[model samples]
Target: MNERELQQLTEHISQQFFGKAFRHQAVFNDRLKTTGGRYLLGTHNIELNRRYLEEHGREELIGIIKHELCHYHLHLEGKGYQHRDRDFKSLLKQVGAPRFCTPLKTVQNKRRAEKRHEYICTGCGRSFIRKRRFDTSRYVCGVCKGKLKWLRTTDSL
Candidate 1:
């Protein structure tokens, strides 16, 4: 949704669930990574990750709004507003709001680059670590003209 729609949705959620009005602004933050939404402690404004809405749809967006509203309402009232706080937990349970935003599955499963591999000489029993894989058939041990056996892959030094 657009910024205007986001603002309206935030306000609507705040009023519907918290029984209070959201006086501060609500806007889509493109730079937000990992988190679905965040409440600015200093400004009392809420910034939502637009990717969350686009990927997860309206229901997930509403949950994030409610979760953020929990923080917003509790912090504004001088109650425990942080995730670990008793008041926050109780309010979340009462409102049936999610305790934490569901993380994007794609983000969680990102593959890291392979960094190292271990190779051993079949004849000499000597081991070698290389950053890149070498053809086992052509490459032979310097110490002995023995076949190279692939062992295991490692991340880094």
Candidate 2:
């Protein structure tokens, strides 16, 4: 569906489930690579992953909408809107919204194959692993405070 359709559907779901009208926007965001949907706290908009609909169909899409709506309504009403809040949990159960968005399998697999940069202390021959590359000039080995050299980077998977 298009943006207009998405907005209409979100509004409909909000009224039907939450007894409130959704005043903010609802749009499909292709940049959402992992989560099925997101509730934007700043703009109070709802962003959905179109790929989720293609993969899981209309029922899943409705569930995602409901999940996002839970965030939307509670946030606007000054209640607990975050996932961990008791108010949020109760609202989710009341509306039958999923507690967590389903993670995309492709994103999960890619995350599992994460690589890390390896570093070794030249003086003590101690090893260190970091998820990101860091400047060797500014940092030293934690164990011996010696000069560090770049070692072979490796993937964890």
Clash count in backbone of candidate 2? 0
Clash counts per candidate, in order, are 0, 0
**After superposition on all CA atoms, how large is the RMSD of candidate 1?**
6.4
Pairs that clash in candidate 2: none
Look at candidate 1 and tell me the lDDT of residue 8. Answer: 91
Error of 1 at 82 (Å): 0.5
Q: Assess the local accuracy of residue 10 in candidate 1 as a C-alpha lDDT between 0 and 100.
A: 85
lDDT of 1 by residue, 127-152 (tens): 99999998899999999989999999
Candidate 1 is scored at a TM of 0.72
What would the per-residue lDDT of candidate 2 be over residues 64-104, giving only the tens digit for each residue?
99999998999999999998999999999999988876676
